[model samples]
Target chain A: MGREMDQEPSVRTDQQLIEDVRNGDRSSYSELVKRHQKGLLRLSMRFMKDLDLSQDIVQEAFIKAYEKLNLFEGRSSFKSWLFQIAVNVARNKLRENRYHFSDIDDVEIGVNATAESSLIDHAVGNILQKEVDQLPFKQKTALVLRVYEDLSFAEIAEIMQCPYDTAKANYRHALLKLKEVFQTRADLHTWAPETNGMFNEMNAKFAEAAE
Target chain B: MTQKRFYADVLLKQTLKKEDRVRIPTDESFYEAMNNKIMMAIESSEVAPGNKWEKPWVFLEPGIELNEGAGNLRSRLSSKSK
Candidate 1:
């Protein structure tokens, strides 16, 4: 359905779209937003985890990217450049939230894998925004870029302006920390299949080793 | 299972609606807001942007080395350099 909609000529080619947006084409800008919003929101969620906050981050990132578009020399893919901007916005949000990522393993607990629980759950899928919000800034950003954005470590490093090792390490650390958090936080003991699966699987192994 | 699936779908739909409500202008106003921000950037001072928060955490993967599960992570990091 989306692909059919995206085929419209009004959207323009990627190169054409960039030129138009840069030249102040409103339709072109709207098309760009249409093409990128869903992906960018998902990316922001990986960082901020909150649907509202992720949407806000993507909105701010788009606004900022538009502001900076004139400075873009197209050194790399425009998508990569845009992604770099989103990461910056999300990371800034993370920092502002006072994330430390310290000793998250200490409070690890098993999560509930079932999302079939309540009216609120009936209202909004399982909200992991809260859990993701608690992740350390870099880890959350890295995980968002890696898993949600499916970006390569090299791309992430370029966007993050960090060593590739740093980006990869950040991602790994973030995953491990999340694993720990889901396990310890009973409130999250059953959030989603993916979360609880990883949570229980990790703890189940831990129990085995302890015995 | 449909009962489980139904609530899941409902929550997802509601969340999606919530997300839509949170979106900033994507219509004509979006372009205008963008132009204003760009004009500000154009008119403003130019300085190198660095990480706004670059505080060094005292522990840098210190605890990671102790955990057996983290070996894969350590290896992944090292591999990035090579």
Candidate 2:
């Protein structure tokens, strides 16, 4: 118990692990890979939609990051830098494959279908995903990074290699486009009663943006 | 800058969260295999000398199953280097 307690305090931050890796502790790179792989894979999935291809993108990103470790100058958090690399790799893959998203039929609905609510939720989820997938690449990237990843606009801008306002604008544009779907589909308005105020807020923001 | 909150954003997040619950693999073995693949890929690149090391995706051909163990990857990389 004493030894276990001692080991608990030795937990290292990502920067320290990076330093160790740079100093020839090869095992530290594996730690880094383990730390970020899930996040990287999820990010790649947002772009590729295919699990296998997303895994490949995550693998290549980690490999590239390991090779380019010396170039990571602490300009951003290591997580952000790693994400930036994965984003670039994902972008290249998208370009190579001509921006193909997975067919709607291929999406797996893993929820039980016996409940009517589950079926409705599944259908609504599909609509949102389809709309999101149809967004222009930059807008989609911004939306995913902001809404799903919960990244700051600054980090999103850095990953996108664009100005901060550009990143914010792209995300806003993506939201406005998504909002149009809710406007046209009366079924969506009844998604949740608690969301009505948020819908009004969004409309107000939309009016402000138009002005 | 403070980001404005919206129902659309909230709904999108909730919907994606549900999708993620199903899509993202939570298996420990899956992560272990992924970590092994990454480490082996790195090691293979270090063993081979060329521009191909710079393009790691050369080893990750589309539709190739990556969970195939490190030895298989090493042999594949060796063949590619030749």
Candidate 3:
């Protein structure tokens, strides 16, 4: 009961947070950073699987975001805006590691977090995420933007600087590849499980982060 | 991994949470640093581009004369050893 009561204003509207941040409320910046850091981290993980490097990219992205906050025109959703920045940062890092690249976009792959089975499943999921990370840069970008960002092919096209059809095709190819990888794995399961209403839960939590 | 979504779900919840009420800091360092960096960047930009040659060490191939001298050094060393 108290949980729901406390969550009411934390994930306040993005515009409100932006306004407060613009007014020199550093706490708002903190709130925004706290609210979005994980997503940015996970998104960066998509490009560079190394947790440390992704952290660096996420930090740099946030600093850049704060510096450029006034330039935001609100055309895109705040998620998309921040994501575009993180994606840019991740891509730059990937470019730097041209020889040693690995996919770290570790999606939840659907195991229960506390279940004993969750550990075994997470290991397998980590392996699969690494494989997904190895695809051509464009394909990896399309896949992550689709699955993690929840953006449509058209939206991905814009972020990826590619045509809509090309983006759609890349997602289809990437998913099919993942499905194939899952089928090949002898890990007692044959596919990636669905994560229903994942973003809804994210939205709820986001609302609670509002200060 | 679908579990990734769950982790992200958990993390997003954790991040949005406020730790302590009224934790705002009353300080001046943040503003000062931001101003300093902005000023430094502006100062660098005001120097017109292509107005002056960059320092020679910035060259990727070393200067053409340096490359020629390097070749001369190699040849001179080889000839002396012979």
Best by TM-score: 2
Worst 10 residues of 3 chain B by lDDT: B55-64
User: Considering just chain B, what TM-score does every model have?
Assistant: 0.27, 0.34, 0.24
Looking at model 1 chain A, which ten-residue stretch has the lowest summed lDDT? A119-128
Q: How high is the CA lDDT of each candidate model? A: 0.54, 0.70, 0.54
Interface CA RMSD of each prediction in angstroms: 11.9, 11.9, 20.0
DockQ of each: 0.04, 0.09, 0.02
Runs in model 1 with CA error above 4 Å?
A1-11, A23-26, A45-55, A93-131, A181-211, B1-82
Best first by DockQ, ranked: 2, 1, 3
Candidate 1 TM-score restricted to chain A: 0.61
Q: Give the TM-score of candidate 3.
A: 0.50
Q: Please state the CAPRI-style docking class of candidate 3.
A: incorrect
Ranking of all candidate structures by their lDDT, best first: 2, 3, 1
lDDT of 1 by residue, A13-109 (tens): 4556768766656456656676666667666655554666776777777676666565554433456567778887877777688544323334333
Candidate 1 per-residue lDDT over residues B1-82, each given as its tens digit: 4454334333322333332322333465654554454344434422223343542122123223322221223434454356
lDDT of 3 by residue, B24-72 (tens): 2234463344344433343332222222333111111111222131122
Error of 1 at A82 (Å): 2.4
Tell me the lDDT of candidate 3. Answer: 0.54
